[model samples]
Target: MSDPRPVPQYGEYATPEEVAALRGTAAPGSPLLPQPSPSPAVVSLRGSTLRRLDRPVTIALIAFGVLNLVQFAGVLLDFEGFLEVATKGTSAEPIDFTDAARIGGVVLFVVSLALVLASAAIAVLMLRQGRIAFWVPLVGGALSVLAWGVVLVAIVLQTPGALPPAGA
Candidate 1:
């Protein structure tokens, strides 16, 4: 027995009549083109993928910011003691923690903490907007370090006696 079903000769998409028409053969019936259906919605993977990656990164940023805040606060709270301990093992001579040095330490702590907080805030905003935000925290941490160096340098420049002589 032969199957009664009509097979598409050109491809599954082309009806037998359409294929026959393309081949210059007379179609048994008019091969009307099927109406095109609306295209399926395009699902963007970027937002969802970034959201998944953002959670862990945000958490890590929070932890890092908190840890830095605590350390910076501790150093600020015990400015002189922190300096003494920090300089103990170094070959450099004892540092004179002057009033200017104390002020610089406070400025450093405040600026660094502010940067951390600002970065965390910006990262959160970026994450909410579905943008990659990991770089913010890294840049913030670097800026904090830069602030620390700048403050320290400023203090040293203000009080040249704060450091030992170049030979010593």
Candidate 2:
């Protein structure tokens, strides 16, 4: 029994007459049809427009710099209090710790002030939108994070033990 439906020709939708003309010219039992040329692959430039690391690094730097500035402000505003709290319990008498704390606070305040200035400069550079601004923030931000870590460690170390030992 022969099939009732007409066999769909290759490139059937390309042109109405081309398919029929080719069908007539093609030898029976030998399927041959002109293949359509492959289209040129399209390459998009959207991904290449911006540097991959620029946006993320810039944002990270800004966040870290802001955090550093806040820490600097804290240290600046409460230098004496922080020093007293840190030295509290470790000393035989409060008077013994006072001079040492005053010196340490001065040193820490100076360092914090420097960090704040550097962070501010980097922020200003970033605002200018120069190409080099991205890198400036990256380095500055990394330093800010490191400074913050140092400050955090110092604070943690200085604070008195909150609880008794497990055996006690």
Candidate 3:
């Protein structure tokens, strides 16, 4: 069976007979021009397919940034404490391990800073309704993982067993 359909032409308007033929409905008294449906930002956003998909990623990135800031502060403070105890005379203490930790701490600081900055960038993109914003959280998440690794490494290297004893 040949399915009868109305043909909508761009240059010319569609007549009632054409619409009737296309829709398989009754024809109107006059020709009906196809009007573009409104996809306003506000209305489209309510049920946007892309936004629905990105909602989880954006939330995770934002939360990750917040957590990073907290951890960043803690890392810096702990590094400072380690410095004070390390500067004392060469005892059986793990002050020597501080050097390695200092390096790890610096890495964590840079990674944390990057996470915060990346999150902001992504947020700006998202607010502008851009797809690039969706990738921002992933970058921050990666940085978070790196920062965690740095902390773990630093902790392992700073353990007392790895340090020189007193009067060394």
Model 2 TM-score is 0.38
Listed in order, each prediction's TM-score against the native is 0.62, 0.38, 0.47
- Residue-level lDDT of model 3, residues 1-168, one tens digit each, is 765865547787876677688797656653455544667766666567667767676766677677767866765546646655665675535434545566666667777777777787767677577553667777777767877776856766666565446679
Q: Quick one: best lDDT, which candidate?
A: 1
What lDDT, from 0 to 1, does candidate 1 have?
A: 0.74
lDDT tens digits by residue: candidate 2, 1-168: 765857769865635455555667644333585645444442222333344555566667666656766766665456656655666787422432333344455655666557656765765666566443456666655665575567555644454453334699
Worst 10 residues of 1 by lDDT: 38-47
Worst 10 residues of 2 by lDDT: 40-49
Rank candidates, TM-score, best first.
1, 3, 2
Give the Å shift of residue 160 in candidate 1: 3.7
> Roughly what TM-score does model 3 have, to 2 decimal places?
0.47
lDDT of 2: 0.56
Name the top TM-score candidate: 1
Distance from true position, residue 9, model 1, in Å? 43
Better of 2 and 3 by lDDT: 3
Compared with the true structure, what per-residue lDDT tens digits does model 1 show for residues 1-168?
Answer: 665868657655976676776788765554554434444442334435556777798769867877978867878766656776787877534556677767877887788778888888988898788687888898888888788788778867776567567899
The runs of at least 3 residues in candidate 3 whose Cα sits more than 4 Å from the true structure, single-residue gaps closed, are 1-46, 49-60, 80-96, 132-135, 154-168
